[model samples]
Target chain A: MTSHIDTCGLSCPQPVLLFLTALRKTEAKEFDVLVDNEVSRENVTRAAENHGCHVTAHQEGNDVTRLHIAKN
Target chain B: MKSLRNIFVSPAGIILTGAIIGLLAILLQHYGNPGNMGICVVCFNRDIAGGIGLHRASVVQYLRPEIMGMLLGAFVAALFFGDFRARGGSSPITRFLLGVIASIGALVFLGCPWRAILRLAGGDGNALFGFAGIFVGVGIGTLFFRQGFSLGRNTTQHRASGFVMPLIMLALVLLYLLYPPIAGQEKNGVLFYSLKGPGAAHAPFLLSIGIGLLVGFLAQRSRFCTMGAIRDVILFRHWHLALGLAAMLLAALVANVALGSFKPGFEGQPIAHTQSLWNFLGMVTAGLAFALAGGCPGRQIFMAGEGDNDAAVFILGLIVGAALSHNFDMASSPAGIAANGAVAAIGGLVICLLIGITNIRRGA
Candidate 1:
């Protein structure tokens, strides 16, 4: 099962930190992180990319963005 | 998907988000949200603390529904979206201590990050020092961040861990409902009600709740954060969230001009002091703590709603910190910074620097 991390209402480093924590905990090689706003979206994606994960993003409605990242 | 993400990520969308907050804050003030305050996280926390007898300051006690409403609004949103997680345990005690000292710093300055912005919007030039202090403080934190300062990693656990703070907010709302201001009475039904001062003036309860809910929802949706706004600008030349604050400034300025609340002067500003040194130092300390803590007070409250127990602990620490300041006269007054307040501010700086050094890793 994919670990879904919701980081809405959180800011840049926070979303990134939470996402990293989830990445560390989950055995699943695949992950999905939900965030709101561009800053968070960018920061989370950057962190995942730094971890050598491949990331694809999807935007929901007007505000939320979901990023799917998988280990190469 | 890239095109979709670009929509709200554009300059206009973030600006609109900031403008909405600014306009709403000014309007809330016009309708009664504390003079020149609009929405201040620290002050609201202090007021709530006093209402619950954390401090017996008779003139500044009121159980503000906006705080309660904000938490609940975020809680509802988190629940609906299936993001409610109760993960914590990342040096909770350390975070609690940071919140304590940060509250002391904010109390000395008489405002939090949002209040600093609100004060500037209302044309109080004293806020210039506050802004400067925050920049310096956060810059210091940024230095530590560059050097690998970290509080440690948060670990996930039980799902119920996240709901603690929201439950506390619910209890507070119940207390607010239980106590109706007795017109001339200060204490009513186990709650303290201020008859004068900033706490005495407020928008109607339901109205405040409605506005708080709207802000909570929008802020949650956009991840709007004051500290993050400035931090991003400092760390990266990114101006996305910065635009939100700029929009708030412009919109609040316009609203102040239209409402005749714009009094551009450094002297006799509402609930502010002319002691420039303390103002700068105060926010510097608070700002550093805020940066170390990784979010502003508003962000903490919203995080609590999402069931982050760490965030809730920070708020609890705020309550304890406020009480300590008031009980020991460690909080500054309009007259000037109290002796202990100065001591506390300096003490916080030393401790925060120490924390920064200790958390720095060799490779990190």
Candidate 2:
């Protein structure tokens, strides 16, 4: 199963915290994290990696980033 | 098997790190983190010291769980990714002294590097002086680096050294949780609270700590550092970190406008003084010490989480220095620079210069 976290309209650290919170509750092995800014992308990617996930793919849109993180 | 830094190992990674923090700082202010101060390392440290009874600065006392969160967040991230390593032994005393000098300098200016940038984005013109001072201070540190100024080598230590700081962070968190802010009062158990003034203003406790943890986790992985940004530019002509700082500044500016918090002026700024000279000198002193110490206060906390006991000692010095500043009336207020802040800034400059002069090698 995959989990999705939408962090649009939020600020830095918030997006990161939300991502971490999602990681804590999910039993899934994959996460799709969406953020609207550069900082959040960096943070989500980092947060995923910190929790033993690997950034498998990332997509960039006009103002949003969708990250695919999978457990190692 | 893994490390978090890999995710944010590129230029884009670092820039995003800065941008996110900048945006959040403004948003946090929009909610309630103080006017133009979202994540001031110096001020937060002072507040922590006040909360712990290090000094009796009546108005500014609270056990900011945000700071505690940063340490713990970094610790958790490092541990999860197997990057946590206990190390120390690089002129520990010298680093501590540098932290004290840096805190004093920041007190004179009433902001750290993060707050200085935020102040400008919020339309405080006086921050221009601070920016100037920061550059000049980094410039001096660069000269020393060119001369082979090194803080000695770090040696691996017992794992317990690393856990000590994390445990302290955990203990602080427990303290904050146990002693909720007293109803309509500033005293909560062993912890102190602020009923009024800038100290009284804050984001919700959970929000602040949650943000702090996120920042800590991300910063640890990205190796986000303000001092290193300028230092890299001066020494290597590298702009990766600089770009991050720029992005952060731009993001904050945009966020401030969106939130209707951008007020342009040199006077009547909240918790700020109009003494341009002091602002410049204050940053100069603080910046130099940060460079000499190899990181800013924010970076220090991150380093401390990674098992740098020396960095932890430096943080301790900062807390004590905050106490000393408040106790001695050396911190600035909206009214003006503190009574002896001028002399203290000058003294900090002297100390930093001496450290730079003596530590540098003729040839590496």
Stretch of 10 with least lDDT, candidate 1 chain A: A9-18
Please provide, for model 2 over B1-364, each residue's C-alpha lDDT reduced to its tens digit, 9 standing for 90 to 100.
3234555757777788888889878877877888998889889989989888888878888887778988888888778865577878878999999999899999889899999999999999999999889889988987876665777656667889999988998998889889978769878888888888878778888888888898898788777888878876776555656877887789999998988889999999878999999999999999998888878898889879978788898898888888888888888888888888998999989999999999865322
Worst 10 residues of 2 chain A by lDDT: A9-18
DockQ of each model vs. true complex: 0.11, 0.02
- Give the poorly placed runs of model 1, Cα more than 4 Å off: A1-42, A46-72, B1-13, B362-364
Looking at model 1, what is the TM-score of chain A?
0.91
State which candidate has the highest DockQ: 1
TM (chain A) per model: 0.91, 0.86
Where does candidate 1 chain B have its weakest 10-residue lDDT segment?
B1-10
State the lDDT of candidate 2 residue by residue for A1-72, as single tens digits.
988877664422345545665677669888888775444566567567656888864656654678888887
Indicate the DockQ of the complex predicted as candidate 1. 0.11
lDDT at residue B298 of model 1 (Cα atoms): 83
